[model samples]
Structure formats: C-alpha cells, structure tokens
Target: MEETITPTRIFSRWRWLYRLILIGTVVLSSVIPVYAQSEPLRIHPALLTLAEESPNEIIRVIVQQNAQERISGGTLSRAGAQVTRELPIINGVVLELPARKVIDLARARGVRWITVDAPVIPAATPGSSCNMLTNPGFENGMTQWDDWENTLDKQISGHAHTGAFAVRLGQPSGAFSQSLQSATAGGTYTASGMFQRQSSNVRMSVGIDFFDSNWNEIDEVYTEIPPSDNYVPVSIAGVAPAGTVHMSIWVWKDPGGSLYLDDLRLHSSSMDSGACAGYPATAGYNVLANGDFEAGTTDWWLNNSSLQVTSTAYNGTKAIHLGQAAGSIAQSAGIALPGTLYTARGTFHRPIGAPWSGMGIDFFDVNWNEISDVYVTIPETSSYAPVTVSGIAPPGTVHMSVWIHKNSGSELYIDDVSLVGDEVPDAFVQSTGTNQLWHDAQPRTGQGITVAVVDSGIADHPDLNIAGSNNSRVLVSEDLTNSADKLKDAYGHGTHVAGIIGGNGSASNGIHRGIAPGVNLINMRISDGKGMTYASDLITGLQWLYEHQAQYNIRVVNISLNSTVPESYHTSPIAAAVELLWFKGMTVVVSAGNNGNGNGAVPLFSPANDPFVITVGATDDRGTGSLDDDVVATFSAYGTTIEGFAKPDLVAPGRNIVSLSAGNNATVTKEHPSHKVGSQYFRMSGTSMSAPVVSGVVALLLQDEPNLTPDQVKYR
Candidate 1:
C-alpha cells in the first residue's frame, strides 16, 4: 500500500472489492441469519403419546425459566380443557382449560395457537367415543346447559374402545347463527349418514350458504333433517357464481341430548343416458301334432308301419299308450293353400328329475309320407309349457300324426294342435225360402232367426257369418263348469251341431254347407272332454238363454248331446227349464238317444222324452229312417225310462251324414270307419250328429213364419 501504484489499477481493484462485499452480504442473509431463535421446546412425542393413550389424565409442566423469562409461567394441559392454578389442584385429573389459560400456555410453550371461543367442554373419556356435547346454550351463558343428558351405559366391555360418553344439552329459544362452507349451487345433492339418537324426540336442521365471485353471500337455505337412516335429498338450482360456498348441519335437541353421524359423503351428478323400446309381430304357422303314434314307445308309426287302431299291448302296457301321441282329429284338421303359415301347439308336464321328453306333429300327403314335422321339448317342471311347430304343406288330402317320446319315466299332459290361418267360412243353411222341405220357394233374405247351440263351443267359422245387429253375434254364452275358457271346440261335436243349425253358405266341392244358412247362433259351452256336464251349470245356461231370448231373437234351442235320463223326467231341473222355454214360445229340439232298435219299445232319454221337447231320431243317406234308428250304434246307451213314450218323433240323416266342423274341413270320427278322411263331407253317426239337422230344419221353417210357437213349429 505504501508503494505508489497506478491510478487506473487502484480504481479497478477497489471496484472488485466492493462487488465481493455485496455478494457476501446477500449470501449470508439468504442462507442463515445471525439473531434467529434456534431449538425451541416443542411438545415431546412421549408426552403426546401419553396424552392420547390416557385422555382422562391431566398433563403437568416443569419449565426451566431462563433469565430472559422466555419460559416463565409455562403451563401444560389438554387443549380444550378448563384449567386453574390453585393449592387444591390435582394432577392427572381431566378438566376444561379456559381460553385465556390455553393461549397463555401455548405461548409459553413456544407455539402459536387459537382457543375455541366457546366454553370449553371436556372430551369423551379414554377408550370412549360419542357425541358428548350438543348445542349447549350460546344464547344464554347463565342458563344451565346440562339438564338433558345422553348416558350410554356400557353393554359389553372387552376391548380398549368399548366405552361411550354422556352428552348433555340445554334448551334455548332464539335462532342460532350457523356458518357453513363448501356447497355447490344448481346441483342435485344427497347427504346421507347413519345417526343414532339417545332418545326419540329430537329435531335437526341443515344450513347452507351460496356465495358470489366477490366472496359476498348471495343466498342461504335451511332444511329440517329427520332422524332416520334414509338419504335426505336436497336440491340447489341456479349457479353459485364461482366462489367459496359454505354448508353446516345442526341438530336442535329436544329432550334427547345427542345424535351421532358416521360415513358421510357427497356425490356429483351422473352423466348417463338410455331407455327401452317395444316388441315384434309373431312368425308363421306350424303343424303341432297328429294322433297316429304311441308316445314313449317304439310304436311310433315312423318306426312301425303296421300300426292299426286295435287293442294291443307294448312296453309292458295293456291298452294303447298313445298318451299325448293320440291326435284329436276334431281339433287339428284344416284346409290350407299350397304354402301357408300356421303354428301347432300343445302342453306336457312331468315330475322332477324325469328323462327328456318331446312332442311332435307329423304331416302326411295323399300317399301318407311324412312331409313335415313340428316338434317341442318337454320341460321337467310341474307346469304345462306350450310346444309349437310351424310351416306346413298346401291344401290336399292330408292326415296329422302326434307323437310323444320319453327317454325314461312317465308324464302327465294335455294335447292341443291347430292349423293356423285366416278362418274359412263354416258350412251353413242356404235360404230356400220355402217353409216346406224340398220346396222351390224363394229363400228370404235378412230375416232374423236365432238358434241356441249347447255343446262344447263354436269357432268363428266363415260359414256361420250371421252377426247380430250390433255386430255381436255370440249372445248370452256362459260356462256352467267355468272350465271351457273360450268358445273353442275341444271336441268336434259342437261344430257339427253348429253346422247343422246355422252354417254360412260357403261350400268346397259341394260339401260342408248346413241347412239354415241365414240364422244367428248363440253358443253355450256346457261340457268338457269327459262328455259330462253339471246340471246346475246347464240350468244356469238355459235360464240365461231364456231371460235374454228377446234380445237375441232366439227362436229355437238345439241340444245335440244328452246325459243319462234322470229317474224322474218331469221334475228334472233341465226338463223344467226346457218346458219353461218352450212355454215362452221357444222350440227345443233334442237328439233321440241312438239306443233304439228297429222295434219301437225302448223309450228315449229324458228331456228328449219330455213332452215339450221335440225328440229326433237318426237316418242314413238312403233316406230310410229307423223306428228310432235303423241299427242302433253299439256305443249309444239304450233308454229305459218309465215314461211310455216311443222315442224319435222323427228322423234325420245321422249315419254317414256329412256336416260342418268348427273350422273348414275338420275331421270327425264316429262309429263308421268311412268318415275318417279329411273330406269336408264326413260320414258320421250319432244322435249328436243328427239333432243339428232338425235344428236347421226349424230355422228354415222360422224363416217363413217368424212368430211360430214352439208347438206349432214342432207340429209343422
């Protein structure tokens, strides 16, 4: 320094020294300060552990007060506990620390803290959990707030946390200010949590607040919360205006002190969208079944060509085990175009664990080869499930075969098969206007005539197109047994009777037309497959027909089926009812029992034998009528009534007489084997097949004289 250096060099060196000093100061200030406090006393981890482990114990303090008085007057206590420094004070005793004392203690302990502004309440005991303190009268500090108490007595004590707390509350009158936070506006919100109250009578309220972008309170809502486990839904419409929204829930204590809440969560709106639509139309027709085979046996016609309708035994069975394989020709036979749509259906039920079983319908052409098959698999439930088949061959001379094959075990069943199509017109009487048989009189048009048909039921056949004036042709039909569900012909008998009485005037190949084509029919179904009908149901049906005769314009009643003659013919309820209807100017035409021999000795069945009923006997195509019938049908029972009336007031073509079935070209089986084909004109023999002929004749007569009484109509 003593040596005189150059001025330029000295100035450069001084500038360098100044920059170094400035950098050193900046570095020192950023990294570490000279006067910063170090190593302040914090609550010890051991003490915190002790406090948590034994919450009921009070904490004590021993402070080393420095000359700077930094640790002077230091105290230790639980945060929310009340505290007092006195000679009588005891250590490890739980007490509430006042707000001032808590702040003072925290400051002395070198910790920044805020005390709960409200009066401090002691927390629940160690190993205890409960809502210990409810709203305890912030309105009035003077009033006692511990009157109502929730005391949870320990029911089971084993684990550390098995204890519960006692909560107390004081009733107050004024509205309490509740500040809430963090709720969104214009959203669907559901607040649900489990809450248990010590007592029943308690009220709760949930408060919410909405804020704007400026942090200003925009709106507020208050709702009452019922004490239950079900979700309480609350909705907020419109926007919250983008600020901190607030929400708070409060319980208004009744006599009960506390309520508990657990598992609380909030959910946002879901963004899902979808729905349901509708159904489709059904598919085409099928052949359900044909009756030519035995079910559950090797006797299927396909396996055995020599199957005949004879008494035989197979598979350890005596009689024919046709089972569901027995086809009902009456129910299934029909006419079809070359290619048409149809469905055949039947039902079968078997016990649990039974072997697999199925039903099928076979269609045969004129040569009787299997052209098509409709089959169904049986389910092993105790209920009937419908089996179906569709798609059939065109109209021709065809026969159906129903088959049931069981792998093992027996089954119970009911068989129903039908050719589905638009209904063809049924055979009906054409108007020949003459009141006399075989006359060339002009048939009248549009004259109202009613024929009552009591049988299985009538199909809406095309041949019987006589609709009532109101378009309601079926009038006063009642099922006495409540068994016949609809006017469906389970047996072919009803259709035959209907065709004979009032068939529509449509015929195929000069066949299937009935006698009285113009008359309307009132269908009454009174029997099931057993060929039995209850007397009460029959009486009710007759009474209904009688009562509504005027409305229906019913002029004649055709009873094609007969039961065994009651012992007393005159006092029989059916006879009485028949007489009453006859007296009411309605003619009753009955079938003379087919039991009579050429000798006139056997009396016909009752109702038929009744004086008021017109008893009709049978005839053949030869026009040679029998004394009752030419040769009595073997199955037809002989009549032996005390009434000395020789049966069969007259005869009609019953033997091999062709008639209408329920549907077009329906097959009818009778005593004659010649009637088995699908020919529309079937050769049938029964008083059943005969009575309808007389009914049609009556309709023709009524067409000429509308007001004829029962007696006059019969006499004519």
Candidate 2:
C-alpha cells in the first residue's frame, strides 16, 4: 500500500474521503432543530394569530387536554386563567383568559389545543308563530297550567334551552298539563317542545287528550322524544276527534336520570266554532267506578259506618245498604259540561215503613261549592223500585257527584246506580282490537289523519259528521264513476266501507261504532249501484288522490274492489296506478277478492296482486272480541298472486261485519233486507268489508307515526 502511493493515487483517495465527510455533515444538519423563541408549539393556529393581534384582550376558550393529562385548576389560576366550565363529557374545560396568556398556557406540558369558545344559539321556540300555550317558556312561573299545584316544585332555573327557567322533573310519577278549550272537533293542532335529559336512560312523552263537550275523554295521543345530553326539539300534530270540544297538552317523564323541558307550544289551524257533530259514545259511559258496589266501597265516600255493602240484589249480586237513618254514600263522578244532558238512575228497595230514600246528582263549581242538586225519591215498596232523574248540566258546573241518602230511621237498599252521559260507545268496537287502543293510556282515534275510500261513496250519516261543528267528516266526495247519485252511496258498499273506517257510532246510540271513528275520509266514488265499476274509473280515482294528496292530507287509500280478470301486476293499468301512488308515499290497501271458496285458489285481481300495495284477506272473529275461534272466511281470497307473490298481506275481521247502510232503497240494502241493521246500518260478508278494517288500522298507524312511508307502513 505504501509503494503504490503516487501523487495521483494520494489525490483520488483524499478527494473520496473529503466527499464522504461533506455528505455526513449535510445529514447532521438536516437532523438538528432550528429555533424561534416566540413561536407557539402546541397552540391552535387560529388562536396563535388571535394572540398576536390582541395580546391583552380577554376571551373565552375551550382547552382540550391530552390523554392521561389533566390541566390542574391551580396551574390555570396561577396563569391568570378564569375557569368557566369543566366539561367532563368532552374532556375539556372552558376558560376566560387574556390573549397573551393563551400562548403561555399552550406551552405547558401535555397541552393539546385551544380554540375560541363560540356562543351557541338555541332554536327558536317551536310553534312560536301561533303558540296556544300560555307561559310556554316557563318564564311565567307555572301560570295557566292545569296541574301547577303538583308541579310547583318541578319548575327551576338555569337549565333552559333559551329562557331563564325550565321544568325539571324530580320524579316520573305525574304530568304537567294545560287544558286548551279553544280546540275544535275536526280541527288540526300541532304541539311541540324542547327537552333534555341528564342520562340516556330517561324517556319522555308529549301527549294530547281530546275531550267532548260533556268532558268525557274521547281520545289521547302521545309522541316520544329521543334521548340527548343537550336540548332537543320534538313535535306532533293531530286532528281533534269528532266529538272533541276541548283538549289538553301534557309532558310525561319516565323513571331514569334527570329530565328538563321548556318552550311547550300548541298551534291550531282553525278556531273552534261548534265544529263537533255530536257527543262521543264514551260520554254515556258510567262515570262512577263503584256504582255497582262490587269492589267494596272503594270509590264511594262513606259518610258513616251505617252504610255498608250487602247481598241485596236489584241487578247485581251486591248493593249498598243504608242501615242507619240519615246515612249517606256519595261518589264524585267527573267534571260536567254545560248544556249537556246527564242521567242519574238507580234501583231502590226498603221495608214497608223504612225511611224515605233518594238518589240524586250534585253539581259543584271549580271551588267544590255546591251549585245545584236534583233528586228522585223512590216510591216506598217491599221490592226494589227504579228511580230516575235527568237534567241538562247547568253552566258553571265543573264537578258532578252522585249521592244516596236516607231521610229517617230504617233500612234502605240501593243498587244499579249509574250516571250516564248522552253518548255511549258501541260494544262491537272491542271485537276489532280497537278496544285495546281505546283503553290505552294514550288512545289513538285516527285524529288529524285522512284516509281515502275509493269505492261507491260515503252517504250522509250522523256518524260521518264532525262533532262540535256543522261539517261532514267526508272532507271531499269525488264522483269518478259518473253515477246518477252524485256523492251518494247508491250501492251501499262504500258507505259500509266508510263506516268501518270512521263511523263515530253516533247512530244506534254508539252500539254500531266504526274502528277509527276520528279519521277524516275522502270519498272517491268509482262504483255505481250493485258495486259495478270499470278499471278506468279506479285509475281516475287514484289519479285524483295522487293530485290532491297534499291538499287533503290523504295518507292512506283503500281500494276494496278488483278487476274481472286476473292479470300480471306489471302490465295491469290499475295495478300500475296503485303502485305509482304507493311509490308517491301513500299506503294503498286493497282487498283480496271474495272468490276463494276454501279451495286455496290464487286471487283473481289486479291492484290486490300488486306487490307494492298492502293486500288484505278476511277472517271471521265469530262475533266475539276473542280471536280464539277466528277462521278465514270461505270467500276471502288467499294463496299466491298471478305475479307469484304471496298474499294477502294480512287478515282482518270481515264476516257479517255491521257497517253503515246507504238507505232502505239502496241496491245492496234492498237486495239484502234481511241483513239490514235498523235503517242506518248493514251487515255484509266479503273481503270488501275486510279491507276497511285494515284501512282503519292504517289510519291509526299514520296518526301515531306520521313520517312513515308506504313501504314502512307495509313493513310495520
């Protein structure tokens, strides 16, 4: 190596070693850090710029901490930062400090980022344009509400969405309600409010109750709000039932974490001006829970030990015994409506010379002051003699009580005591599963929801009239069939269908009520006498519904007819028309034709065979509310459709179902005179009757969940 060291070799080796040293120096330079003393290492870029512009300015900011790192309050206080809020939910803290201190604070160990604390504006009070609720914001301190006495401690400050106060529920046992007397039957109303919950387990519901003129509860509806840490808004709208003269809006909470509510609002589209057609059937229901004295003396106010329940039968096994003279037993029935008729009747029996006994009604004002009293003295007899007293509820009558009294020393037995209002519900409504809905805490009567009946026509019936107003619930009657009787049901089929959907049971004294008695109907008359119509007529009816769906708020369309021939749904014009409506967001319910003779034949129909629409079959509930004896009606079409789709989509009670009859002279009524129920109702057996039961159910579903689409309804 030493011998080869010439002048050229020494120059090449030294040049290569110098190149390697220069490359190493360059790499070392890239690894070294450049320094700027004033630059912020962890501060947000926007905050850094702001600090530069306004070093001494005070501002609010939210500082986020790194994982496993917490900004101690002592450190923040020492750095001239005023802590505003500790947000454990986001692992952050809101602070107010000088802009110059923000950079210093960000330079601390384990600091993440800091940004300006922007102001958050809450949403405007829902339904503010026409908020019917007084003191809706809770800023007025619980005034104008019906249950303020119970909610006095519930109202609190500092937790509102916008105002200074909100309703904070301490327990989930009761409700906060406000009675709205301006709501009219058939009028539409919207209710909304803002709510917040401290934990995800809390649940709440905003509800409305419709009451008739007699103060009888007709229907009730409820909407649930989603759980959220912060304030969220919820809204629901419904139509006042046919007999609704007033209503109440309320909010109820379920057990869990804390719940807060504010800005409750209610808006009505129209004023109540005698819109109710008649009192609801519930009006005539017995208000006294223990009128029969079967449950000991639970509801009765026993004035003394002289009164007791005995095995003296007037109607029921147990009756009330006034064993001592001047003894009295009373029960508070309910609130009374002015100008409404109330009947107090009871059966009384006494020994030959027993003290004179009487049963009567007592009316009281809001203060519980006795306003007036009416009594009927029972004739002295060994056997029980019936005594009755009836009168119109007087003005200023807020409460009613039924009392039984004895004048002198002797034993008197009383039984079958009843206080019935003018209207009563039909017993058959229970057979269709509607009784379950009626008895629900939040009953739904298809209020504010519209259903289209594209059959013959809806005739003029009292049950079809809107309660409290002089208007027909048949919002519109379109004659697509060009029949001689315009807007009238000459075939008696459409009337039956309409009645099944929304007849209020006003006739027959509420003994023949329909399923969804509160639903508004739009009659699209496509069939003439004898239930005859062409496919084009049905298409025209569907087109009309499609065009006016928004105007009428039509949500469900019921077609209880079928074509004369079976055809593929893909090519059938009627099927295409129904599908178009279904896609347009209308729940189309068609009846499986009455062609099945228990042979399990494929249905011969078009719209019913359409895969998109809801096809309904028929079942016989055996004239009972229990479904144990239910069987498919022999004529209810079943099996697969021509398009290879399984049908019908569902089954409902249809055999011998009693519904509205057009008249004695109507075609079906005249042909089937034996099936006529009185002069106002008809009993028919077919899938034509089954479809409307499902149609009424659809109306109820839409009333509860208005946002559901046709597909969603079908799935539900």
Candidate 3:
C-alpha cells in the first residue's frame, strides 16, 4: 500500500535527521581537540614536543603574563629569550628563545599561557624597507613627538606637503624628537622628512641621536639641508653606535627662519630578514599569511580562549571558529605609506540564529598605535557569505591589520581571509593572445563598440568605470528582475563577464586589462540578486536590448547563462528572442553550459542550442601564456542538440580566469571564497567565462570594421 506524507510528518523526519547529525558533530568536536588543547599542563603540546625533540633549537613564542607582573627586557634576557615584537594589545611579547628555556620561562613569577609565535603578513612591502617612526607626517597634531623648546604650532588649514596638517616651528634653533624603541644597535637607520621654508636663506638639519642604557646620548649623525622655497624632501642615513639600546629622530633648523615640517619618516636602510616571508608566495593576491586556517592559528592573534581553528570550512580543509563574545582573529603588517589603498575580504557562516559579524582593517601609525579602523558587516545568513571593506589609508598610516571580528552572537565560522593592495594578475588575458594583439601596428580596442552583459547586474568598479571626454563607458544599467531600475552586481557574475569583455584594468595598474577595454558596456540585469532568473526574464532583457541597440551602438550581446531544461531551438522562446536580435545585426554569444560528461553525448540546451547565435565552450589554459598545454574543461558542455545540430561554435580560455569581483556581499565570492584573486577580482571557470571572451572579440571586430553584419563578423 502506498502512503501519503503530510507537512508535520516531513518536519518530524527532518527533525530526527538534524538531531542525529548535530549529535554526531558534537561528539566528534569533543574528541578532536583532546590532543591539541591538553590545557591543564599550561602549555601547548606542540611546544612540549619541540622542547623534548629539539632542546637547543631556537623557536618563537608569545609570552603572556599576569596583569600585575611586568615582563621587562632584563627578565626576558635572563631567560635567554630575545624579544622580537612587543604586542601591548594583548599584554604579551613575541620572543625567540631556545626550546629548553621555554619551560623555565613559563615557570617565572606571574606567568600566563604561552603559544608558538606565528608570522603575520604585512599589508604591503613598500619598495623594500619598512617605516618605523610614529606620527612622522605631523597628521596627529604632534602627538608622538616632543618639542624641545615648546614653540611649535600645528598648521591645520593649508601649505602642508601631504595630508591636512603640518608642524610649524616658531623658534629657529629649536628641535623636535621621537624615540625609536625598536631600533637595532648595529643596524643602519634612515631618516627623511619634507620641509617647506618660509624663507630660502634658512638651513634645515635632521639626524639620529643614539642613546645608551642610562638614557644618556652616546653619539649623533646629522644631514644638512639646503634652502628651498617649495616643499623639498631630504633624507639622512646613520648607523647606530655600539652599546645603543635605542635612538631618537631629531629635526631642527638654524639661522632664525620659520620652517614647516611634514611627512617625516624613519626606516632601516636594508630590508628586514624574512619580513616578506610566511605568506603563500604563489597565491597571486592573498597578502595574509595562513589566511585559510589550514595551518591552524599560525599567523593570527588570539587574545581569548574561545577562538579556535576548526574542521568546518566554507571552501577548504579548515576554518576559524569564534565563540567568545568579543573575539577576533587578526594579522598585522607594515604598510607602504599614507594614502595607499587597501582592501580586506573574507567569508563567514553562522549555524544558529544570526548576529552581527564583520571583516575590517585596523590602521596603525609608525609606532603601531591604533589610529583608526573601518569595517563592513556580513548580512544575516546561515550559510557562508562574503564581506569586503575597502578604503584609502588615512594620513600617518604606517601599519595595518585585517581582522574577522564578531560581537555577541551564535558561533561564527570564518575562512579565506585576504588583505591586499589594488592590483590583479593578468595571466588569463595574456594566455588568450589579447595582450599581443593590443600592441599590433593598428591596434583595435573596440573604441566605438558596445557590448551588453545579460546576467546578474554589473557593480561599480574602477576597471569597468571608464570614461572618455564626454560619456562614461557604461551606456545603460537597467534591471529586468523588477527589484530596481538601477543595477548593482549582487551575484558578481555580470560584473566579471563585463570585465572580461572590456575592463580597462584601472584597478590593477593596467596589468589585467581586458580583451577590448575601450568598448562601452550595457548592463542588462536579467537575474535577481541571487542569480535566479527565468526564461521570461531573459526574453525581457533581450527585447530591451534589441530596441536600444542602435541608440547605444550595442554590437555584441553576451549571454553567459543557459536554460535549466533542454528544448528544440525552433520551439524555445529564449532561442526565438536571441534569434530576433541576431537577425537585427547584433552578434549574440551564449555559454554552451557546464554539464559535459566527456562522452560527447550530453544534450545541449537553449538558447545555446540555437544555430543562429554563437555558442562558445571553455578551455583550461592552466594560467600560462602558451596554448601548448590547453585542454577542454571537463565540465564544459559538449554535444549535439535535440534536433541533431552540433553546437558551441568556438572555444576560449576560461578556467580560473580572473576578473572583477563585486564588493557588497556578492554571491559567487561568498560561495567560493578560495577563488578570489584579490579584493578587486575573482577567479571562476566554465563556459560562462568562455562566452565573454568571444563577445569581447566580437566587439573588437565591430570596432575595426563597423560596416560588417553579424554573420560577417562571426565569420571573421
């Protein structure tokens, strides 16, 4: 006898399954951490293992102590520990010591827990060296430096070399000074600053003053500056004297003249050892070390006990679990200079009721003082979602850190965090022979052509936001999904497709330029924010493009999507809609779908099955410039249509192609956080990426020969 199921019965069955899975997970979680967190012993098992196996090996560790117990340099030196970094945020010091001394160091008076010191990634590597002075630009109103004569006033309005403020000296012979506590005794330090003179006859002097253990000045070296009316930059190099524990940067003027100082800087002359190491050197745009958490909490700062690296992940083998009320996992690095742009991106998931969580950046001055912070929150979602925060570094920004933080809420899982500068890789463009074509005798760049992207909306990005003398590259931005008239790339697909077709590579400093970068783009958002669309939505977008083709010079129509079910091209409505546009002289490009089984028998779907339009398949170029190793992607569609017509007129490079990534909670970026190249671009595969390559070529052809019909252009 057949049985019928009601809603209550279905819920009851699902409830049992959910309970069983939850119980299994609970049991597994309790069993997994017993070895890693053998806590009652007051030391990590890894450290204990290192101490036993390699007693004399030098290892790095973070030493935490009781609140009342101060850990001075003398105390660490007594234990044979050399301090590497002082982290006052968590009241700890990062040190390197022989493994045998760690147990003795931990048993010291008022000792707290100690963990292995993992290396963190810097926001950027400026030239080669890193700045080490705080408030060097006087943007903080003279907060970190001391004025010897107390005759200085901060200039707030204008005449500053960089930011909004500068320090003005009233007394000519007076000086300003700041102590460099992190300086090395025998290392060479360089000092540079900007000087704007009120009178050209005055002389400016800047140098480094070395000091010994008793706060006594040992020796000094100075660099004299010639007079200049406009602000001029001058630098001085000095080697710290022997027995110098620290040094101070000094700036002074002579001959009784008013001089303004701004943009002061002090740094080591040579690059620090292993300063740019620790991160995955091959990951193109990832600047955070161990961001995937696959190596546990190696480079992350954990202040509380509730944070852990767990097995639950969005796109990798491991992810971070934040259980504390106000806990975060962060890694800090030294920045290039003020006004440099940075972006922080990551993914988060909540298993229970949603609460607030964020990905952010904490900006620091030259002395590692917290100057300011900015963040972007993830939406309420049970599944993983991407979040991005981007902005220019404020004045006096010398160091910064990217963090995934959460307030009180259900437990949150984070994965694939990255903090990177504004640049992207160009391997995909070079592999497709587009870069070589760009340098041809009479280079064609789709100057007068327009391409329409029919998928998710196109987001605003520096690469696609190009403008000419009068008009912007974006001709029209309309939504057929009925959500809004204007467009935003909530799903990130259309923006990537648009970038592949005509991005100018402004965000990447022209390294990742598109195939036809000068072409105009028409964003016809046919899908909803989550990339859910129907045949009706596609038809609506196609009809609108047909009507406005002449007005916008829309020579190419790119459909990087397919129908759910297969149908004959003669009967499918989407196929008819695309055929009408093709008959009207618009070149239509469609993705051949990603359901191939490598048997050459998979049924093709419409409008990909339509013979009138150009259907493109995808090839895996393996991120190289040569096609010698190219292969057809296993998932790329291959087959004959229902009516026995062979489809996919051409193929193009598509696997792991990097293109523009939408910023505001983009769906694909969240779904596959590992595919992100940097904050500005994402890597994706399938014929959806392949179709745009052909569409971009169509735009180039139309620009070179504007009189060609759709059929003639396709023939070329």
TM-score of every prediction relative to native? 0.36, 0.41, 0.42
Q: What is the lDDT, from 0 to 100, of the residue 703 in candidate 1?
A: 76
Best by TM-score: 3
Give a tens-digit lDDT track for model 3, residues 114-214.
65542111111111113566556553456788877766542322245544346667544767889876555666888888887676666668898988887
State the C-alpha lDDT per candidate.
0.43, 0.68, 0.68
Q: Which RMSD values do the candidates have, in order?
A: 44.0, 29.1, 31.9
Alpha-carbon runs more than 4 Å astray in model 3: 1-424, 467-471, 484-487
Tens digit of per-residue lDDT, candidate 2, span 352-394:
8776777788888889998898888877897988889987778
Model 1 stretches with alpha carbons more than 4 Å out: 1-441, 444-447, 466-477, 484-487, 505-510, 597-600, 623-641, 663-683
Task: Indicate whether candidate 1 or candidate 2 has the larger TM-score.
Answer: 2
Deviation (Å) of 401 in candidate 2: 46
In angstroms, how far off is 560's CA in candidate 3?
A: 0.4
